[model samples]
Target: MLPSVVLMSALAVGALGANTTYTYTFPAGFNIGLVKSDELSSWCQGQRNECPSICKGSTKQNTCEPSTLKFNCVCADGSVPDVSPYIQTVPFYVCEATYGQCIDAHPNDAEGQRACKAAATCGSKNASAEDTTMSSTTTAASTTLAMATSTSASQTTSSVAAASATTNAAALFGLEGYSTGLMAGAMFFAARLFL
Candidate 1:
């Protein structure tokens, strides 16, 4: 008697998902699908971390994990209530991917704004007038510093290039190999490697 009731519940949940285990059946020959919704819930909850990373967000469908025996849709409260096939119409603010059907919708709108706000995001500066002016000054200062750094780097590079050219000229002069420790090292390495 208890088993039959459990099977009935599975059937009911399976109706919502063509591939969902929420609604199921007790076909005489085989039991291809036998899931207790409550049990499924626990199983799904355990696999929550592995759900699609794309589902991360405030307006997220935080229901059963993708690992459910059969759950392709999320409930409003973030539950995987797979009464889908049995459900003829959609409730407000839900992405219609239940009942073996998949439909993506903005979890945002007039009614959804409250939820969105609760899921706050770090946004651009909503500064006061004085703060805005201060920010502009900081930005200007940063630009100036960047420019100064660029100029300093260019100057250093040019000086280094010029010094390198001078050293190359000394090298070409026949006394070229005498100026630095590198010359001695190169000669040693060359003799060792070649010989």
Candidate 2:
């Protein structure tokens, strides 16, 4: 009688779909195809470091990783409630990637700004500005220092390049000798076996 009651309760829960797992599968080549497809657009376009803002209401329920390359968005519980209705049929990966790119490009938070500015792409805009902007007084004082150091800097660069070239040549020769020794040993063994 107890087993019958437990079986009936299990059936009731299954009928309600309470514990059902939902998965969203993307079509093959969707990620690569997204490069050419302009149909789906991110809401955070032109906004830097704003990927996390997309999860305002569900901040605790979802994870947002903003990157200079792309923004990633996913449910913390790994259960994504169908956002298809809101996304104009865009795949979740596309949405996240787009958001991450925009967020990484336009960081608003201090840490994000530091990271974005440090990135190679953003460095030109952020670091180059500082490099190009020299105060007139400081530039005047450094003029003599630059003249004194230019020769040494050139010599240092030349020596470093020569060292790098020598290291590469030595590595190549070592690898070639190792390969030749192995082949010679294999051929000698084969000759003895056949004889």
Candidate 3:
């Protein structure tokens, strides 16, 4: 009877542990899909205190689960792996500013630069005084995303009304057309709110 009770307790604990959900909060404006896996690995290597090999291994290993789109640490036999060690959550503004900064610093990294610009587009330009580069990058990427979306006239107007008062024409439309430009602007505004 004692052995059976102990076995049941251990089984229950294991079952609960397997399904535990860990929520990792990413920056408000940053899109996980925009950045590639390799870029994340590279970022970890450069920014983390751990050895680059271990950082790279962490990324390569299935530590990052596809379901959550965030890394989870799973240790192999006799190995202790620190899962989710590389995530650095910053304010939306800082993340945008950093992306803009990275564009200049790492010119050769096209994917990283594009991902950074995409993130910046979803954030606000309120940090412009602190980092002009971020402002510029956000403007360019927002325009690109808007153009890719190519919002319709009615959609533009309704979206503009929904957008925050702080949103500006330049921030939304890339200054293309005073009337239709509002569409892109509103779309960007929406992205900031939701993404």
In terms of TM-score, the best-performing candidate is: 2
Which of candidates 2 and 3 is the stronger one according to lDDT? 3
lDDT of 3 by residue, 1-195 (tens): 111100011112342453334343454444445566666554443333232233333422223332223443322222323323323312232354456566765689888777766755333322223344655689989998877677665577777776754367456565556657778789999999997
Best by lDDT: 3
TM-score for each predicted model, relative to the true structure:
0.25, 0.26, 0.23
Q: What is each predicted model's overall lDDT from 0 to 1? A: 0.39, 0.41, 0.44
Candidate 3 residues lying further than 4 Å off, grouped into runs, are 1-18, 41-62, 65-69, 74-195
Kindly list the per-residue Cα lDDT of model 2 for residues 1-195, writing each as its tens digit. 111100011112333555433333433222333343333233223222222233322322322222211223333332334432233223333444444554555666777655433431210122222333544557877986897698789889899999999999999999999999999999999999999
* Candidate 1 whole-model C-alpha lDDT, 0 to 1: 0.39
**Lowest summed-lDDT stretch of 10 residues in model 2?**
1-10
Which has the better lDDT: candidate 1, or candidate 2?
Answer: 2
Error of 2 at 72 (Å): 68
Indicate whether candidate 1 or candidate 3 has the larger lDDT.
3
